[model samples]
Target: MTLSREFKVGLFIGCTAIIVVLALLYLAAGKGVFENLHAFTVSSKSGDGFTEGMPVVFSGFNIGKVQALELNEKGIVLIKIKIPDRHVKWIRSDSAFILYRPLIGSARIVVNTTNLNSPPLDEKKIPEVIIVNDINDAIARIEPALERVTQIADNVERLTSNLSDPKGDLHRILSNAGKITTNLASKKSLVEMVVSDEESVKALNDSLKKLKDITTNVDRILTKVDKMADKTDSEIYGKDGALPQVNVILKDIVGKLQKLDKTIDNINKISSDTSEGTKDLHILRSDIDDTLKTVEDAVKKLDAIIGLKKAPEFKVP
Candidate 1:
């Protein structure tokens, strides 16, 4: 019932080798070693956050891993990805890949298939690299713009501080405007007093009334003068007017004057003829005396016709 030492050591060694082999097989299977794998190369400019053995995910499922990375002849990075044959059909020729690198988390490669009906991606064909922007890269891109924004904020802060200072022009201008508004509001009662003054309104009304009275008086005077002018016109131009009587009387006076002038001329001619032809001077004197008396009577008749109380003294000359 005793075991040999050599056989015991050999048995121990064989059991140990078997356990190690089984463990290795189990690890390989767990890593998809037996699964049919297909590979395609992805070209990129540089390796930023990508590395070997990184999971390539499809629709949030880990379907493959990055197999290797190398630089090609053109200095571009070439990343080879290995996917299982069963999952290879999930990636089509029309598929898109996106690398998402967040600020606080690890980077991941995402694969999307646009058409399930299209042909699967060929292993021999080159894959497209998904360019992604990391947080540091995005921040670097906007650094200059952020600097300008910071300068603008500083200027605004200075302006705000100046506006709040009592010695500043902006503050003084606002204070002056507020004071003017207050002064105008305080003088509102004076404006109301001037507008509501009863004495000035009464004086204006009285002046208007006096002007109306003067106009009425002027109209009445004009009416009186018109009436007087009409009366004067009637007296001078009517059928029984004084102007017609004066005209007739003047005509009669002119005729009497003509007759008197003729009578005096005839007397003068008779006196001159008697003085030359009669030898007796007494008879010529008597004729001259009678003509003088006749002249005196004509003068008296003319005075009576003119309604004179006494005839003017009639001198022979």
Candidate 2:
């Protein structure tokens, strides 16, 4: 037990080193150093009750912790969380992070995983923080619902009272219905008469007889028209009918028209040549005068041969 001063100093140094290592191991164990962890960033508009080291809970189990909180230049509050690998698979791409503040409790960060089979959210993806309804907000939402419930209750109460009262509007309405039923029962014969009156039956019978006569006339007329159509078809389009004769006449007319067309074409060509040759008006007038004198001499000789006393002068127009 009698140790030297140097030995005592060495012992003290050894104990200090051992204590430091144990503390480091304990810290690492508490922070899950041996377990696989995924880090994700969550952004919020307001960081009212959020802080570093807040627990991220899923189904009442704490699976992660907020590692850091930072406010960037854009004034957004960013919360960085580290979730253990075992629970990280539960955080889906469509998972929502809700910060719920109860009426009489501290704010809790809740992770809601809607789709279990969805792809896991990437560790580097930053999700938007969704703030849940606080006590005041929930109360504000329920006010309209409460008012609707009150209106429904009031209506139920009025209906109950109206049903119980014998002299109420509902009672009057039922009484009128009963009266209508009684009146209808008493006038059953009159209603039947109105539905089937004697004069209406007579008129209906007469109309049926007239419709039968009209149908007969229409049948006769249709038969006559059918005969007439058959006769006309036989006369017009039957074999050895007028249509063949008309076709032959039409062919003959067409042949004459072709000959007339050729004659017109020849006449047009002759007129064109004559116009081109007689470009001088004086020569054309002299030729016309000589042809007219020859025609006059022929006419005079024909009149003497026919023993005509005098022949009238023929003028060419």
| TM-score of each model, paired residue for residue | 0.40, 0.35
> With candidate 2 superimposed using the best TM-score fit, by how many Å does residue 66's alpha carbon deviate from the native?
3.0
Lowest lDDT 10-residue stretch of candidate 1: 308-317
Which sections of candidate 2 miss by over 4 Å? 1-5, 33-37, 68-78, 84-86, 135-317
Residues 123-213, model 2: lDDT tens digits: 7788999987587698998999999999999999999999989999989999988976776676535543444465666686699999999
Badly placed stretches (over 4 Å) of model 1 are: 73-76, 134-317
Collision pairs in model 2: none
Clashes of each: 0, 0
Model 2 poorest 10 in a row by lDDT: 308-317
Q: What TM-score does structure 2 among the candidates reach? A: 0.35
